[model samples]
Target: MEKPQPVVVKVVTPEDREEAYRIRIEVFVTEQGYPEEGEIDHYDAVATHLILVFPTSDTPRRAYGTVRMVTLPDGTGKLGRLCVAAKLRGMGAGALLVRALEKEAKEMGLSAIVLSAQVHAKGFYEKLGYGFPDGGVEYMDDGAPHVKMAKTL
Candidate 1:
């Protein structure tokens, strides 16, 4: 199969809300078996910024992956709500989203970006130049172990 061209990344708007939510529902609720209610919470509206990916023109521009960015009072940025469609894993969608978020952060005058990466995915984030803040792991959401990683933009 032909590889997908580099995805065009953009800031999610009101029009993209449903697409983003649908992607999340597919990845988190259906594939990962997360409870629908728990997968989406209040933080979505108040503290999240979504990155929408249109990976190809031939196919519908579905929300293949999304990462939420939150700006702290000190002007730092936090990335959360990361999800990628199961069928599209190993295609660099998550990394592209992170890079896009970093660009957005730089534009926002933030010095760095942070994320609580699931332990299994730490290597993926590390390869993209993020370093773990704490030496050990943290079981933050449910029993999933995660490491807080960050990169200075």
Candidate 2:
């Protein structure tokens, strides 16, 4: 069995924002069937984006995962648009993205982080300390069942 490649997460620079967008397109738009136009939205203008990449010298730095955090009025960061390349699933890249986002949230002085997680991924979020809202309920989000989750920073 091959060991997973080491990955690093960095805040997406203005010039490299396309790298983040491309990863999101591959995961959400092309693979998950989200509308391409909707994949890039107004929130992107206000959110802080991060990208996961390999540091191998053999190839140019290419992003494999991406996530964003937007500070909300309630003093919480809204975590959204998380995606990892299909080929890299189960490589701990997703957890690293979430951990990096948590650090970003702390730097922004956010009280907590909130997200609407796909129902199937509830356990993933739970493992990262995200909990459902009191009396939480699942609802349709863009044709998929999702549940509200939050984690204190």
- The lDDT per prediction is 0.76, 0.85
Q: lDDT score, residue 153, model 2?
A: 85
- Model 1 segments more than 4 A misplaced: 1-6, 55-60
Off by over 4 Å in 2: 1-5, 57-60
In terms of TM-score, the best-performing candidate is 2
Instruction: Please list all clashing residue pairs in model 2, or write none if there are none.
Output: none
Candidate RMSDs in Å, in order, are 2.7, 2.3
Pairs that clash in candidate 1: none
Query: Residue-wise lDDT of candidate 1 within 53-118, one digit each (tens)?
Result: 655563445677787787888788988878887766888878878888888889889999888888
- Backbone clash count for every predicted candidate, in the order shown: 0, 0
